[model samples]
Target: MEFAAVLLAAGASRRLGRPKQLLRRDGETLLRRGARLALASGAARTLVVLGARAEVLRGELDGLAVEIVLNPDWQDGMAASLAAAARALAGFDGAVLVLACDQPALELAHLHALRDGAAAAGCAATEHAGALGVPALIAPALWRDATDLRGDRGFGAGLAQAPDGAVWRLRAPELELDLDTPGDVDAAIARGWLDPA
Candidate 1:
């Protein structure tokens, strides 16, 4: 499917007390790695939503082939970033793969799986921690729902509310490990998934 990729990296990282997007993993910032993965995932285009440390995080992306979208209302929550991305892709006609920069273990294979898995269902998401979550593919038809989202909520919340079997789910327990706190950083470092800062 010809689609666009949206990398959600606008959070202030309040819990981690730092910009997790700048976290080093395999010698590259998490934000950069996520963008690379999205770019290489066969998406015709990629848009990165930035806010909190927009300027600094923008530097992390450097020469990546992606369009940077600034979300002035990022403080409103994840939904605000999603809404911004939705607006940026207003006239798009393909699926959208939404990703988060905090997943240290996210890989290209999983991204491909989600895209392919969404071919018929029109939507596919990671099933981790007993919930449907991003690293998800949303068909153009549902793109409007993203713009309707409110504070702090992400597409996962909408997926959960969908009728049973409305969204395809991929078992991805590995994605449950997100860098949301200092302990998460420690865990990623101890697991050799991230380099100590």
Candidate 2:
């Protein structure tokens, strides 16, 4: 099934005290890596949401075949970015694969799995750390619900609300290591998931 990829990278990274989107491993920034993975996943379109550090983050994505979506209300939190992506994809015919840049272990195969799973089950989400979460693929029928998300809530909140059996879950332990703080960066580096600065 055809689908678009929405990479959420608008957060200010307050906890990390640095733009985690710009974090590097093997010379590529996380944002760029995510965009590349999304594009390589055969997504019909790839849209990146940028807010805080928008200018610099946009630089990371330069020359990539992806759309840039600016979220002015990024300070309001993840939901705002989700809403922006939803608005950008209004009327789209297929599923929407929602992803975040902080997942250092994100890979194209996993994204493809989400797309394929969603096509078969109507929706799909990563099951890691004992919870359902993004990167998730939501069927078009439920895309509108994304616009109603509030505050920091994101696709994970919606996934949690879905009736059992409505969504397909993929086991992915690597996805559990999101870089949200200095310690997270340290852990990623120690784990060799990221290169030390």
Candidate 3:
């Protein structure tokens, strides 16, 4: 399937008390690592939505193949980032895999499974942190549903509206880890997600 990965990296990272996008480990920023993973996953294209420190974050993506999109309303919340990415891929015919930049442990295999699942089920999501969420593959038919999501809550409503058994569920334990705060970053480092730098 010729799917695209939409990486949401616009958050301000208030809890982390710093710009998590620029947070480095092993000399690579978080956003850059996420984009690299998306590209390595075999997505036909990778689109990263940037907000907050957009200019600074853009620097992280230098030499990467991913497309960069700016979301001016990112302060409104994650829904804006989703909408921006969905809009960017509007002309494309394939599914859009929405990803969060904070998942340090997300791998190429997990993304490949989501794309394959989405190709079969119209939508594919992983069961993580006790809930259904990204890394999720949204079929073209369901892209509008993602655009309709509002507020900080994000794609919950869109997922809820999926037809019975229409959403493919993949087990991904790594999805449970995210870099939401300083301690989370520390844990990720201790786990060898990245070499200490």
Candidate 4:
């Protein structure tokens, strides 16, 4: 099945004291790396939503084969970015895989598995650390719910409100390695989750 992908990278990174999207692993920023992973995972197109440092982050994307979408109301929350991405992918006929920019351990293979496993499923979310969340594939039928999200919450909120069997859980422990703070980045480096660059 054909699929599109959206990478949400519009947060201000207040906790990190810096743009987490700019965090690097092997010399590539998290945003760029996430976009590349999506592009290489059989997605028909990948749309990256930038807001906090749109201009600077755009440069990180450089020549990557992914569409850049700016979310002017990003400060409002992840929902804003999600809505912006939903609008940008309005014409897509299939599912849209949503991913965050802070997962330093995310790999193309995991994304490919999510896309493949999402075939005919209503939605497919990554199951990690005893929770189901992002790095999910939301079918076109569920885009309205995603766009309806508000505040700091993401589509995960909608997924949580869904009745049983509404969302498929794709077990992916790798997604649990999100870098939300400088300490997290340091731990990842110390744990060898990130390569020396």
Best by lDDT: 1
Please estimate how well model 4 matches the true structure, expressed as its whole-model Cα lDDT: 0.83
lDDT (CA) for every model shown?
Answer: 0.90, 0.88, 0.83, 0.83
- What's the number of clashes in each of the models? 0, 0, 0, 0
lDDT of 2 by residue, 22-75 (tens): 888788999999999989988899999999989988889889999999999999
Q: Residue 173, candidate 1: how far off, in angstroms?
A: 1.1
Ranking under lDDT, best-scoring first? 1, 2, 3, 4
TM-score of each: 0.96, 0.95, 0.91, 0.92
lDDT of 4 by residue, 51-72 (tens): 9978888899889989999999
RMSD of each: 1.2, 1.2, 1.7, 1.8
Clashing residue pairs in candidate 2 are none
lDDT string, candidate 3, 5-108, tens digits: 88999999999888877766568777898899888988888999999999988988999998999999999898889888878877788878888888877778
* Cα-based lDDT at residue 92, candidate 4: 73
Over 4 Å off in model 2, which ranges?
none
Q: Which model, 2 or 4, shows the larger lDDT?
A: 2
Candidate that beats the other on TM-score, 1 or 3, i.e. the better one:
1
Better of 1 and 4 by lDDT: 1
Per-residue alpha-carbon lDDT of candidate 1 for residues 1-197, written as tens digits (9 for 90 to 100): 78999999999999888899999998999999999999999999899999998987888888888999999999999999999999999888888999999999899999989988888677899998788888999877777788888998878877777776668898987788999999999998998889988
